[model samples]
Each structure stands twice: as C-alpha cells, then as structure tokens.
Target: MAALQTRALSKSYGSRLAVDRLDLEVERAELFGFLGPNGAGKTTTIRMALGLIAPTNGSVEILGLDVRRHRSEVLPRVGALVESPALYGYLSGRDNLRVIGSQLGRVSEKRIDEVLEIVGLKGRDRDRVRTYSMGMKQRLGLGIALLNNPELLILDEPANGLDPAGIVEMRDLLRNLAAEGKTVFISSHVLSEVQQICTRVAIINHGRLVRLAPVAELLQDGGEFEVKVDQPDELVAALKRQQWGGEARSEDGLVITAAPDGRGRSLIKFLVDNGFTPDAVSARHRDLEEIFLTLTEDPVK
Candidate 1:
C-alpha cells in the first residue's frame, strides 16, 4: 500500500486556486521530495494532507486511512515539522520533548533518551533551547516528532537553516530513517539537498505538478557533454554526419544528451578523425539548480 496518496487534491482561497487537482502516490520507506517556487502552494498542500485544513475538492489518504475521516487514527502514525519549528527558549531540550510527549501519552525516560540520542541531542539535551543553534533546534523538533515512533514523516525544508555539515548530517539521517522502513517526505527549495537525499521527486509550478521522476533518471536526461572545437559550426556538421550516439545539439559546444564517460573519449576521437582539433572538452552533469531553473522557467511539458 502507498504510504501516502492524494487524489485530485485541491484548495482555493476566494478566487485564487492554491492547489489544483494535485495527484501523488508515495510508497512506504521512500524518501520523497516535493519542490516548487514560493507561492506554488507546497505548504497549503501539506496542511491539507495533514488534515490541518480541509481540501476544497479532493482527499488525502495516509497509511491507507482517509485523512478527513480518520483524523484520530491517522495523525498518531504521522510526524510533521512545517515551516520553522516552534521551540520554547526558556525550557531545556529534554524539557521540550517531555512537554510534547506529555500531551501525547505517558512517555518513559528511556524513550526520551533514545529520541535525544537519535537526534544527536544527547550531550546538550539538558541545555536551554535558547543556547542551541538553528540546526540543533531543528533536530530537537525532529526528536519531538519521533516521540510517537511515527511511520510517516512530513518535513518542510528540514535543512533550511543548516550549515554544509548539518545538511550532510540531515541527509544521512533521512537515509537511515528510510532504511529503517520509515517514509520521509521533504519539501524544500534547496535543490542540491533534494538531489542528494531523495530517491524520487515531484515538482509543482503554479500550484500544479510539472514533473515527477527518479532523481537518477532526471539527472541523466538533464546532463550534457560539452564538445569544444576550434570550428564550432563545422564540427557540429561533422557530428551530425557521425550519427552521434545520443541526442546532439550545438550551442557553446555539442550538448550531447549523455554524461561524458567513455563516450567523451569516442567524441574526441571522432573530432580528431575529422578536420577540427578541439580547444577543450569537459564533462558536466546538469546539477539540480540548473535543472530546477530550466523547469521553473519553461512551461510544463
């Protein structure tokens, strides 16, 4: 069964449509990424999925339970950290978890210790939240979410304010969670982080889904081999004659729709066999930032 599913989910405020017939299916133990520009209704969709707000025309199902109808049953199995996490500065990290845990049910100290250790707060868990960094606070919030041993976790920009090292840690943490059979859904503007962490991604533009695919497949299609030559037009014509193995087009060089592997060597040999001697050749896989810009700029295909 899918860990989460949304069927023609939609929301509208007055005359403005926030989410337009969004449909998605996320499987169990998958690290799913949700991406979009600001005002693309990512938050609105999340809120509706969490049953914080009612959808105007559709439904959300988590763990095979309809969110609207099984609020009491569904919520306990799901954990979420939306926007910035809320923490009490006056209280210690341990106290914060205790307070949140107290509301849920009777939580043992061993469980508290385990959560604190899992989120990397064991050493400083007794410290006041005000003294903790943004990364620490985020982890603390995550610890609270894990208190119930949730099966599904929904995070909005979980790595928003972390440093490079913190980002890496968060990535590893998500991967470990998924390995442990926990489903993780993250929505973030940090394309690189999403690229590294998520197995599959869904991009929404103008409150509608524009693209959805595996991270590897999308990167493979987006990357190109830069074929530099002394004569651009002539070399391009020659490549056309050679029947380039992959889709080839001429711009700054031959933007072949393939990563430069052994094919790069073949391309160089092909160029050398022809009249043109290359100036420089380089291989570059289109990173998430470029792919994201291209997708967001152009109309959804």
Candidate 2:
C-alpha cells in the first residue's frame, strides 16, 4: 500500500486557487521530494495533506485511511516539521521533548535520548532552545518529529537555515531515516538537495504539478554529451542526421548534445571511421538546478 496518496486534491482561497487538482502517491519507505518555487502550492498541498486546512475539492489518504475522516488514527503515525522549527525559547531542548512527549503519552527518557542522538543533539539536549543555533534548533525540531517513531515524516525546507556542514548532516540523517524503513516527504525550493536525497520527485509550478518521475529519468531527459573532435563540423553534420541533432551545438572543438543518444564514444568512433580523430569524449548529466530551471521557468498555461 502507498504510504500517502492524494486524488485531485485542491484548495482555493476566495477566487485564487492555491492547489489545483494535485494527484500524487508516495510509496512505503520512499523518500519523496516535493519541489516548487515560492507560491507554487507546495505548502498548500502539504497543509491539506496534514489536515491543517480543508481542501475545496478531492481527498487525501494516509496509510490507506481517509485524512478527513480518519485523522485521529492517521495523525499519530505521522511526524511533520513544516516551514520553521516550532520551539519554546525558554524550554531546554530536552524539556521541549518532554512536553511533546507528555502529549504523546509517557515517552521514556531513553527514547528522547535516542532521537537526540539521531539528530546529533545528544550533547546539547539540556541547553535552552533560545541558545541554540538555527541548525541546532532545526535538528531539535526534527527530534520532536521523531519522538513518536512515526512511520511517515513530512519536512518542509528542513535545511532552510543551515550552513553547508549542517546541510550535509541533515542529508545524512534523512538517508538514515529512510534506511530504517520510514517514509519521508520533503518539500524544498533547493533543487540540488532534493535531487541528491530523494529517489523520486514531483515538481509543482503556479499551483499545478509540472512533472513527476524518478530522479535518473528526469536527469536523462536533460542530459548533454560532450564530444571533442578534430573536425567539429563533420561531427555536427553526422549528429544532425539523428532525432536530437537539432538540439546539438558545436563549440570550440566540442560537440554538445547533437545526437540521438548523448554518448561520447559512439560520436568519437563515428569521427574516427570518417577520417577524423577525436581527442576526448564525455557525458554530462544536467544538474538539478538546470533541470529545475527548465521545468519551472516556462509559465504554466
């Protein structure tokens, strides 16, 4: 069964539609990425899924239970840290966990320690949250989310305020959580981070889903091959015979993406057979930033 599923889920505020006919499915133990620019309905969709707001149309299911009707049963199994970390300034890190723990019913100190260690806050658990750095506070928020050992975790921009080192730590932690069979749904504007950490991704733009696919496939579509040859014109001409030829260009002894398959060796061999000796060949996959720009830059009609 899918860990989470939504069918034509939509939300509208007055005349403006925040989310429109959004359909998505997250499999068990999968790290799913929800990506979009600001005001693209990513947050709105998440809010609806968490029952923080009602959808004007469609429905949501968590663990195969209807979100609206079975929230009591579903919510307990889900952990979420949306937008900012919610922490009491005066409460110590461990005390904050204690407070949340009380609501969840007598959580043991050992479990709190386990979560603190998982988020790399074991040593600072006794410090007041106000004294913590942004990254530390983020980890503490994550610890609170993990306090219940939830099956599904929804993190929105969990790396928003972190420096490079903190981002790396957060990435590793998410991977560890998924390895333990927990389903993670992460929403972020940082495309590179999502690409590195998620197995599959869904892109939303202007309140609509633009694309959803495996990370590899998405990169493959936008991949480019670099072919360095003695005769650029001949290689360019040869590539022009293929379907993707029109998309290829020649630049400074290098032929870029001018062939059906963006493979360098075949182009070099083609050149060698045709009386040209190519120096080097390489394949370059599109980075997450490029792919994201291509998908989101075009306006949603």
Residue-wise C-alpha lDDT for candidate 2, range 95-184, written one tens digit per residue: 999999998788999999899988888899888999999989899888898999999999999997788988999899899889999999
Query: Once superposed on the true structure, which residue ranges of model 1 sit more than 4 Å away at CA?
Result: 222-224, 228-233, 237-284, 298-301
Model 1 TM-score, 2 decimals: 0.85
| RMSD of each predicted structure | 3.9, 2.3
- Could you tell me the TM-score of candidate 2? 0.91
- Candidate 2's displacement at residue 261, Å, is 6.8
Candidate 2 — which residues are off by over 4 angstroms?
237-244, 251-253, 260-269
What lDDT would candidate 2 get against the real structure? 0.87
Q: What is the lDDT of residue 272 in candidate 1?
A: 75
Per-residue C-alpha lDDT of model 1 across residues 114-223, encoded as one tens digit per residue: 99988889999999999998889998888888888899999998987778887888899899999999999999999988999999999987789988889887886644
Worst 10 residues of 2 by lDDT: 258-267
lDDT of each: 0.85, 0.87
On TM-score, the candidate that comes out on top is: 2
